[model samples]
Target: MTKTKTLRIDHVKHPMGLLSVHVFWCVAFIVIPLLFILYYMMIDGNGSLTLDNIKYLGSKEILRCFGRSLIYAAASTAVCLLLGYPLALIISRMPTRRQTTMNMLIMIPMWVSFIIRTYTIKNIFNDNGIINQLLRSMHILEKEGDFVKFLGTPGLIIFGMVYNFLPYMVVPIVTSLTGIDNRLFEASADLGASPWKTLLHVTLPLSRAGIISGITMVFVPAVSTFYISSTLSGGTVTLIGDKIETAFLNESNFSRGSALSFVLMILIIISMLIMNKFGDRNVEGVAV
Candidate 1:
């Protein structure tokens, strides 16, 4: 009989060394930066420990900016989910080659740096841009300064978020949908369930984890985005990220910025917790 050979962890050489490298990487990058933020959050310019930074969060303007950030993020996330869920389902239902092609179309924009993508959006929306030019050529506007005013608007900001983050929502949901066994879908249909009923009871419940993941991915970045608002809104609209950047860069208040950063983290955690609970309830309801 041939001898059986099996790899064992105990026999592996330098396992600790491999783990040490990972530990060092985490400490150098994640842990150290977070510690620095916490340290800065607790200190004033005089190098004295202070609670002023935490208290600064209670100010009206800051709170309003944070609220706007939350609203914009939620809006963008909702739109992405609404648009992406259907789109992902469509893509998942395609043949393999078509799926590959459609997926490439969706992901091609992401290959470029977001800065460049955002700049392209700015050009497309700004005065004297393609839309206005087309409108003017069609006799929609007679004067040069009579642009459609797409830039510097709340709609533009939300549109930008939807454009950029829609893929984040779509891709994950596609993955989840494609992973589902077709047998389950067929079984649902065989049980005399209508298409819509099967979709609600089977497809949606199976896709809950993907939906939650997509929300987390889209919301966290959308809520904290500064450059998108800055470039598109031309400083008219400000989100929490804009406030943090101004606190650190323009005002040169590191402590306040760090405190804001801490608060943003807490807000995201709370939002995620609520979303997770909601997802669990929905799945349970469907199951019952």
Candidate 2:
């Protein structure tokens, strides 16, 4: 009888050297920058942190801006969900060829610069904009500038947000909807469930994970966007984003701005945590 020799298998542990490279870059680029911002804010203060900084932010204008930002964020998110859910469902049900094309079309908007999109919206809602001209041509309005105030109002901010963030909602929902096992629906149908019942009971429940992800993606960013609010609303509106910008640029009050920024960060983190805790089970999207 011949004796057979088996080769021993060796497991290679990841080198700490390679891992250190990643940690180095992360700390250098992300962590250090954040710490610097905080340090700058502290220096801009009266050489130390103080309650006066918080009290300063409580000024009427700043507080109002923060409150308005929250309201606008909430309203925009609601609108995005309303429109995005149906659109995603429709897109998911389309033929593969059509679905691919439509997805490309949706993604095209993302390739455009955010500032450009906001300015484009500003133009469309302007007094002498194409919308007013078209309305006048159609005799929908007897005047050109009638109700043209949409350009510099909360309404326009919300509209721009919905346009920009619609994809955030749609992409997640489409992913979730498409990943759903068609057999589940078939099984539900076989069990004497109506199509509507299947959608309500099975389809919707399965899509909750995507819905949560979409809401967090859209809501958090919308709540923090300053560019869209300032540009589209002609600087009339104040959002948390605008306040942060103002703190850095206009007032030279870096510390208070940093504190406000820290607060904003905290809010985003807490909200995301709550959202994930509520819907983490349903997530099925590929992580980057």
Candidate 3:
């Protein structure tokens, strides 16, 4: 009792220091910029607070862009889920070493610059590009310019979004699938459930969290991607992101841009909330 020792907590101090740094950057960068954007969005040309900026959302062009963005985002998320879920399931069942190798290969595309990837896709789909050249060699195209056009189409833009954002969808799902208890599968089999039934009832239910996370990840970026749309659409399509970019860069109208940005942000928040509600319902259903 006389020989008491004090335990100095240096580990706690290191984490506290890291937390402080994180908070500092969050405030200095994210919070501050968002506040400034909000201010700009709410004000008039005279710097007086007004709703004119937000009211601009009622314009037909803005509405069309917003609608197109929603459609593209929804389609991309659906495609990613359809493609990624099976890939994730397959990868999760593989041997650990092989799983790692395959995952690494899947992720390799992400290491390159996003703009470069978009450009590469654009080139591949261009009238005189690889696709056309191959078709020409195979006599599928009667002449040089007679090839099927892929660029500047709605399908092409959707393809680009799916191609670029597929890894984001797969990684989270694979993580969730791998975390499922193997015994659950055994239990399902013992209960006379087929593999597909087990997957639908057990695996999918447990993996809702990852599906939600992946949807949010893919949808948000897909909605906001002006570069991919502009590059692949060849000016045939205009998304909300393209409008925002034009408002700021071409028109030099920060107020309009900020207003569009705020509206897009609100839409994203609402979509996320909806997905979260769906995920919660799935969890409750599974628990029951």
Candidate 4:
């Protein structure tokens, strides 16, 4: 009985069993949709899995959309990091009560309807909007023309992405930052390390995993987002999401859409890999 128990424990601890379980879980969720798309593609992908379909994706417009989506996602992630990091740092330094209150305020926006908020932003950026009115009234602008070009531009889309994903970045960073022992910073200070050096050497390194997670969460969704960009940029900004929508709706081609969607997934995987590579360098001491 003792020998059998030991053998069972060894078998259960084998890496293969754990790997199989992990693979099964992944298949149950991620792989299933991909398999469905693949099966659909093989069955009705433009009568044949021809290079023409692939070539079509290589067209200037589609390529441009793909690049634009990457650019937008990257820009959004950068903006979110810049804006969220300091806010999270400030919250981390606050007393427990104040931090809780500030966190609630930060999350309050998430409860709002995304579409409604986006439309409100559109109104704010419209030619006859509050900003333009304020600028004109204050004589900051000689005329109502070219005040900021907020609407129907990349800037608005970037703003929308930053506004929406700022919470994602802040939450992760705060989680990681709060996990850090405050004594480490105190010790660094006692050792005469400058504030910047302490952050660079200690705080920032400890929060790397959170930074990577936030970047991934922000960038991937932003890349796939269609409505925010379309609404803010007035349908002029071509993105990979726009291509997927057009293929599915305008072209009435599910196969092409699935293919484009697959490509987008690939792009996300690549982006995640790149981010992980950078993040892993300092992740050794960071808690999961």
> lDDT values of the candidates?
0.90, 0.82, 0.91, 0.82
Candidate 2 stretches greater than 4 Å from native: 1-11, 37-46, 58-60, 143-147, 280-288
Please give the lDDT score at residue 211 for candidate 3.
93
lDDT of 2 by residue, 130-243 (tens): 888888888888765565457777778899999999999998898899998889889999999998998888888888888988999899989999999988878877789988
Checking candidate 4 for backbone clashes, the offending pairs are none
- Give the root-mean-square deviation of each candidate in angstroms: 4.9, 7.4, 5.0, 6.0
State the local distance difference test value for candidate 4.
0.82
Candidate 3 root-mean-square deviation in Å: 5.0
lDDT digits (tens) for residues 1-288 of candidate 3? 111212233546555554565677899999999998999998877888988887899988789889999999999999999999999999999999999998899999999999999999999999888988999999988876687889888899999999999999999999999899999999999999999999999899999999999999999999998999999989889899999999999998889999999999999999999999999987998798
Q: Count the backbone clashes (under 3 Å) in each candidate.
A: 0, 1, 0, 0
Off by over 4 Å in 4: 1-30, 42-47, 141-148, 284-288
Q: How close is candidate 1 to the true structure, as a TM-score?
A: 0.91
In candidate 1 the C-alpha lDDT for residue 197 amounts to 96
Residue 1, candidate 4: Cα error in Å is 37
TM-score of 3: 0.91
- Among these predictions, the greatest TM-score belongs to 3
| lDDT tens per residue, model 4, 207-241 | 88788888888988899988788888888887888
Sort every candidate by lDDT, greatest first. 3, 1, 4, 2
State every prediction's TM-score relative to the real structure: 0.91, 0.86, 0.91, 0.83
